[model samples]
Target: MATPDLRELYLSLVCLITLVLILVGGVQVVRHGLKLLLPDPPPPVFAPPPEPADSTAMLKPPRSYEQAWQQTERLRLQRQAIRGLLVNLVLLVLAGLIYRAHWRRLQIMRRT
Candidate 1:
């Protein structure tokens, strides 16, 4: 019925948090791999561009908006890829930190 010591509680909490984070990171890596492997559903195509407000406007035909939209989509996809890579990189660092801590501890105990 005794309460757990603060240090033990904190350690357990940290271990639990690290385990959950590793699980989530692993899932995301798997999902990204699947996205690469499986063909994604086709992006819904947009309708043809509308005519400009000016009745006599014919010099440029006002297609700038649609072009901008296409550019935006490209940028968004690139951002997503970058974000995914960053998340994986962080996960790698955390995993290495956890492994190094355990390894050094083992080395110390062996010397003792």
Candidate 2:
């Protein structure tokens, strides 16, 4: 049997690589989607009110600080999930496009 030409071989290799990339990207996107959809419930934050004191009252942190810290943590988690989702989506799309293009080229080469 005749050996495949270099162009065809290269195109086939690219198609395979791109398909792998697409699969990995798709998996990551799905994982990220699940993370966003069913995110772990944020742990409860509780801080007891400071006891009444004349001098130390000014030193004690307010209850709002605890609330603010919790809010910041939640926001950070949300941001990470969103960023992951976006990045994975971009990877999936680009890889899919590349795979399609290379597959089409391979098909055309085979037709000749």
Candidate 3:
């Protein structure tokens, strides 16, 4: 049996670390994407009228349809950003794996 080379072991370890980071980052990106897609609780439709004695009190206006549409658009942008991030991460992970495979093949050829 051939003894393990320290350099080869170190390379393998580094590759494993990169793999874990890629997985973790992908998961976080997906989670954030889901959070963005989820709908927020609707605002209360009606509020109690202010007391007549409290002249300084102002009634809160209900959210308009335009305002709601804008909020939805913002959420859509957030989801799109998350999608881009995840896609980039997947590409990076694929590249890293290809590089590691090539490195391993070279190492094996050198040993023989």
Candidate 4:
């Protein structure tokens, strides 16, 4: 078996992340496209106003809540993703510069 090239692996990971960004952006585009194409659904045919539950029934808060750990996990993931994107962009720009620099070097070498 042959050893894998780390540089190639890194590039593939960056490409995958870029693909995910494109997919997310594409989904938003399609969602807006659908909204543009279709008329909004008419409000519920039977307009029933929200009713206050009887006190006799168990009174519970209607607000939704997330556990502290869950929120922390979401924040962690968001931080990780943002960091990954920033790093990937920097890598891409750096790679472009390296390629251009090397290409120019090669041209100079050939001219010598």
Candidate 5:
């Protein structure tokens, strides 16, 4: 029975891991695209009642709901991008470790 080569095994492992990471990134991109294309329905708005004459009533500044929704969507996209970047970074680290192991094995084999 022929023994498997360590370098080839490690290289294949690295390639497989890289492929999986790419697929995951692609899926995330597609999901984000879909989210952009099909957004949730607008929130229901209720009219405010007449202000009471009581001097104790504190009035707060009015904020635009559309602006809030835009900010939220922006944050969501940013978070998704960051997540994708982190995943790619992890995959690169794993590949680097595997490559280092493969190089060490080659060095040892050469020394023999």
Candidate 6:
């Protein structure tokens, strides 16, 4: 049996590394995508209402404040999910491309 050349070994190592990275990135993308698609509802706030102000200006209802909080929380979660998904997607694509390129190079080396 012939020993593998340095270039072949290097290409094989890179392909293996990229494959692992691709798998990890793909899993992360799926997880984030699911979170973005089906986010869990935020738990209800059971805290007491804010103290009444002496000002004549009308104060917002407690329920309205709770609703606003929920909305803000949801938006924040959505942004996080989107960011995670995008980051993972980029990782997956880059890893896949790298793996492909290296695998092709390795194959060509073997052929030659």
Best by TM-score: 6
lDDT scores in order: 0.62, 0.84, 0.65, 0.50, 0.60, 0.88
**Per-residue lDDT value at 97 in model 1:** 75
Q: Give the TM-score of candidate 1.
A: 0.51
Off by over 4 Å in 5: 1-63
Tens digit per residue, CA lDDT, model 6, 3-111: 9989999999999999899989989999999999899897787664546676323444477888998999999999999999999999998999999999999999999
- TM values, all candidates: 0.51, 0.78, 0.50, 0.39, 0.45, 0.83
Q: Under the 3 Å rule for N, CA and C atoms, how many clashes does model 1 have?
A: 0
RMSD of each: 6.0, 3.6, 4.9, 11.9, 7.0, 3.9
**How many backbone clashes can be found in candidate 3?**
0
Q: Write the per-residue lDDT of candidate 2 for residues 1-112, one digit (tens) a residue.
A: 6689999999999998988888898888888888888876667665456566765666665778867877887788888889999999999889889889989999999988
Which of the predicted structures, 5 or 6, would earn the higher TM-score when compared with the native? 6
Residue pairs in steric clash, candidate 1?
none
- TM value for model 5: 0.45
Better of 1 and 4 by TM-score: 1
Q: Model 2 shows how many backbone clashes?
A: 0
Mark the regions of model 6 whose C-alpha exceeds 4 Å error after superposition.
48-61
Any idea what lDDT model 3 has? 0.65
Q: After superposition, how far is residue 90 of candidate 4 from its true place, in Å?
A: 1.0
RMSD of 6: 3.9
Local error of candidate 4 at 66, Å? 4.9
lDDT tens readout by residue for model 5, 1-112: 5565876576656656756655675576566556556645444444455477763234432457556866776777666656755665565566566656656665675556
